[model samples]
Target: MFFSAESGQINHANGTQYFRGLEVKEFSEETATGMMDSLLYAPCDYVITQSYTCMSREEAKKAIKRTRRLLMSADDDAVSQRLDLDVALDLLTSGKIAYGKHHFSIMVYSPSLESLVADTNEISNALNNIGITPVPAEISLSAAYMAQLPGNYNLRPRKGELSSQNFVELAALHNFYPGKRDKAPGGCDGFTAHPVRRWLLYQPA
Candidate 1:
């Protein structure tokens, strides 16, 4: 994919385009509820893409082995390594955490190129305030955009390992503020659009 000066967007040979993509690299050590904090008031159009794939039992074993090997190679702190292993063990045994891999990217779109930049900065700042780190997709912009497509996990955009519990926490699944419908009685048109978000899980291929 390449940036088009004329269109002010990343352009594919086939004509798909996007203004910009920011990836969720790491979250702050401390996070609060509502991952999409200020997004509700976004003045420009945007998308929050999230894909999650549940790991098979064999995949979990391999992941644990790979993590242990990495820790050994890096000579990480013993306590840190133990903590990692403990979480893995807890996933395998206690089953409190559902093992999975996920991809989370936010794409902002606007007719004005300058607006795209400003909106991106605003979104990033808002998320940073809530302890989320979103960085430019850079070379992975194409892959990230594609990964957001429904049933497009087969392309295998880069993902980070996480547990269901952790995903729910990062996703702020507990954030629920119901609003009145647009045409409800008594002038209760508080929300413009209220969408029901559902988590679509895919069994590992």
Candidate 2:
């Protein structure tokens, strides 16, 4: 079962639907486990879970700025660029934005969707200022759909795992496990990282 964003209708499919501009990749159980492990092991910056609500442009911009600063301060340039901070900023400022009650999460490290009905000119201008190509609604919708896949996991490292300070200071931090450690059957230590520190874990009723 899948959905067709182009037609704006849910469609049933025996196989995975390959929509253009959407990233849909099949992974084996081993691969899926690895993906989840990588995310689970990484450090995190911030974990925010909030009720569904609309934010004023000012509030949104402030949030965006904070996220941008955090990303930039990180050691990984890819992390700073991959989240598309500019697009999120534009969406927040687009006005009248609302997320549904069932799922309106804004995982900082995950890919998200902006309203298709937002003003293209405004979004384009915002992207242009950041030197990012404007992504069309179709692509954005497809990306959002991909994120909903059960096999797909968007993970970020927990705070204190990766220091935003200078390289020297970051290296000086202790290498102790951030969470409780469990002993595996083979006498190996197992660590469980909490990426969703404050987020709700939604499940079907």
Candidate 3:
């Protein structure tokens, strides 16, 4: 796998590639060559290369289930709510939840709409305490969205699949070129070309 800092893309010869703790798609030979040419003409601060083992679909599903189980077990009324809030704060401070580069959305799954409505203020305050004052419009909790949450957790590389060097290089790059807190969604910020699955556990905030 070859990651280009200039493009923020993870390119691979074939199959899938893992970079920065995420799984990105493979690039065609022609496209990969063109990317290389572009990088040569406009050099970037760093280029990362690595070898990794990807997780199969069953393995990925099992991992997601395990994560969900852990989150559910940890969530126990106010105690778990406070813990989740603290985790979000810690992630923000550690640069894991950068504004535009990587942002977290709270997804609440309740048995009924009334339950969600009742917990709205509690959720809002938790985010507010961490300096992330989201507008009412940004919060959404529905059976439809909740049903799809498990799918969103799929396709991530298994833990320890990536090398230590990959983490080091990614941390260095983020330090030098930390993404802005923009919400427009375009360019490399979206990372649409080489989509990668994120590892954040999506539990109610």
Candidate 4:
């Protein structure tokens, strides 16, 4: 839930040595809706979504809509700092993509991805839509989510080495691969600057 360097000023608090972003005091549709509204005015430089599971298209649509509302109205400071990002990959509503709820996960800086998938033509028409790109959940999930998991657990040589296999498989469920130490061009295994650049671009001016 927290990325130190990626979190900017929020990584450390004046009063506390460590700070986690956004403690949820409440959870509900109204709260979610309210949060979504806030993010639009305070859009992130980049909004990344990582999933260890697949989301229905309908769910993806709903997620994109929520993201759009947030990115569009996010405040300049928050946007500049890339705050208030909705990063969970879970499907918000129920049902199937074709007949039920719409669900989408994205790594972008868009007001919404629904248009990209449902209304590509309209997306082309909109100005300043760079943040609106809709990549498959797998790409971002592989790159962002899996790559960010803390591998820094307490190590015990006598207890045997920590297995990255579980981590790798879990990430793969959502189409992600474990961040590999080896550097390969366009490799999905490790954290890279590409995601950061995406975030910075949408950062408020």
Best by TM-score: 1
Q: Report how far residue 202 has shifted in candidate 4, in Å.
A: 15
In model 3, the Cα lDDT at residue 194 comes to 20
**Ranking according to TM-score, highest score first:** 1, 2, 3, 4
> What ordering of candidates by lDDT runs from best to worst?
1, 2, 3, 4
Q: Mind giving the per-residue lDDT tens digits that candidate 4 earns over 29-117? A: 11111222222332233332222334455555565556556666874344532232232222233331121211222223222334223
* Candidate 1 lDDT, 127-153, residue by residue in tens: 787777888877777776677777777
Can you write out model 2's per-residue Cα lDDT over 88-139, one digit (the tens) per residue?
Answer: 5555456524222111111222111233223233333433443334333253
The local distance difference test score of model 3 is 0.32
Alpha carbon RMSD to native, model 4: 19.6
* After superposition, candidate 1 runs with Cα above 4 Å error: 1-18, 30-33, 78-84, 172-178, 181-205
Relative to the true structure, candidate 4 reaches a TM of: 0.18
TM-score preference between candidates 1 and 2, better one: 1
Candidate 2: count the clashes.
6
The prediction achieving the highest lDDT against the true structure is 1
Better of 2 and 3 by lDDT: 2
lDDT of 1 at 100: 84
Which prediction has more favorable lDDT, 3 or 4?
3
Q: Candidates' lDDT values, in order?
A: 0.67, 0.33, 0.32, 0.29
Worst 10 residues of 2 by lDDT: 156-165
Which ranges in model 3 have alpha carbons more than 4 Å from their true place?
Answer: 1-100, 137-205
